[model samples]
Target: MLLGYLLEIVKDRDKAEEHLVSIFETIPQHIDRITGDGVNTWCELQRLARTYLAGTMYADTTSEAKFPNTANKFSALMNDEQHAVFCSIYYYGKTTAQLAQELGKTEDLIRKALREAFAIIRKAS
Candidate 1:
């Protein structure tokens, strides 16, 4: 499922698989933290994957090179703010608290945005 999400962002099967590998590669180092009491394991893993993918997005050195095929069907359904929150969390690995501070909104509002964004994705899918 996570790979499916990444595929939509990168629009490259090989790169998406590579990103999946990168996420799994950190499992040994992050196992304790991810499996800590009260921690949501899946969410932690998703955050790790998103952070890794964000690095790729930011590090794409060719400024003139466009990211081709970026808008898959589901992504097209997202509004600007929904896209912003979704990308910040799922692509940029930002936490709700971090996004709240950055966007000058309450954490609750950030979370609500994320929830709504996910709902949009779900409906589109």
Candidate 2:
């Protein structure tokens, strides 16, 4: 699951595998937080991976990032706006404010779209 998620983000098997190992290496430091009650482990790990990659491959912002196909399972359930909000925030480590500015949307609306996106993902799960 982690590798699949990483693949969706990095789109390179070698890089994703290398990142998976790097992410796993930090697991011990985050074990307690990761084991918390009601925590979505996959989401947390993905968050960590995003943070990790943000400092590495994603650090150079010269080129724009690419999103997964909108028809991918989770995103297909969302409207175009929701998918954009979710992918920018979730996959690219963008904050709601950043997305709002980039999308020319109000922060509250971006947040609402993010909420709806999460609801769709949770329902799919």
Candidate 2 lowest-lDDT run of ten: 57-66
Estimate the TM-score for candidate 1.
0.60
Encode model 2's per-residue lDDT on 12-110: one tens digit a residue.
Answer: 889889989999999999998787899988778878888887887654332234676534678888887888888877777888887788878899999
Q: What TM-score does each of the candidates earn?
A: 0.60, 0.80
- Report, for every candidate in turn, its global Cα lDDT versus the true structure: 0.71, 0.80
**In terms of lDDT, which candidate is strongest?**
2
**TM-score of candidate 2 relative to the true fold:** 0.80
Off by over 4 Å in 1: 58-78, 94-112, 115-125
